[model samples]
Target: MSYPTIPAYQTQANGAEKLSREHPVLDFLIDHQEAFDTGKMKTEPYTVFHVDDFVFTKSDGTVLPPGEASWKGLLEGYAPFNKHYHEGRYACIYERNGIWEMVGFANVYANLLVPGEKTKKDQSGRQWDVLVPGAFLFTCVKDPTGPKGFKVKSMTLFGDGVPVVGEMMKRGMVKAEDLVK
Candidate 1:
């Protein structure tokens, strides 16, 4: 899977550098930095509302209602983080066949945090405070560089049972139609 590496804004010693306005998704995150910092961002879970005729298939090929599917077994017994579950929107911009393409995703994350232990080193040896995703909803081009662009991929609704893709769309967290364009 070829995921596009979006560039991060470089910061100088004096202060944070100005971010490029070319990326809307990145711009959105920057604009809401305060909301993120203050821990006020809220995104509804996918299961709270009903969808007409929606079915999801697990990795093992079992089909079930979108609301009933579970990724609990994969989380190592860590519960979902409801208060800070939604991690906002992101975009991966890349080129294929000399054509510019963008893939967007709404990240709904589930984590487990120990009261006393606040951080752990990830596989890359970097310490992170947030629990690794017990479950997540990834939208638009799963793994990227495939024919599955502009669709919901693998996801787990552990925290609020909200489907990140659909719920984000409803709340304007992401523009579903713009993802594939």
Candidate 2:
């Protein structure tokens, strides 16, 4: 078996698996379309949502942007390309009940972080991988060099990050007043 890599296709594969972000997520969403569901699906990549102050980050200790970066060169050591979990550099933000909260992550893969994982470090004294995560999601297109342009038209949600934040706020760990503005 062989997969055809179009030198010039409708969409370029910078990272995300399918042709577009909507295809997979939409497929998954179709099943639960009745639910007040606004999130990506399992097919998409994912990362973790740590219980940070007001921001969520990947396990590497660096802030994972929300979406994918157009140029691989744009991805820095702080935000690695292949190492990055979501697409573009933008996390998915949803305003629920007048709250501009981050409902999911898009730029990097969301599922990387799971519960009970421990922080691992490398010889450079920097974190290599994060073990624990609150949620996961997927971004679209990491690289594109054709007419379509490499990018994720839609982002998908996986695991569960919203509840993580909600729990934090409810537990008095995170301040809702700071975000509910």
Candidate 1 C-alpha error for residue 90, in Å: 6.7
Error of 1 at 62 (Å): 6.6
Candidate 1 accuracy as TM-score = 0.28
List RMSD in Å for every model shown. 15.1, 17.0
Evaluate all candidate structures by whole-model CA lDDT and list the values in order.
0.35, 0.30
lDDT of 2 by residue, 104-156 (tens): 32322211222322244422243423312223332233223311232232322
lDDT of model 2 at position 46: 24
Per-model clash counts, in order, read: 4, 32
In model 1, residue pairs whose N, Cα or C atoms come closer than 3 Å (at least 3 residues apart or on different chains), thus clashing, are 45-162, 46-161, 46-162, 46-163
Model 1, range 6-43, lDDT digits (tens) per residue? 54432211122233436533343334333433444223
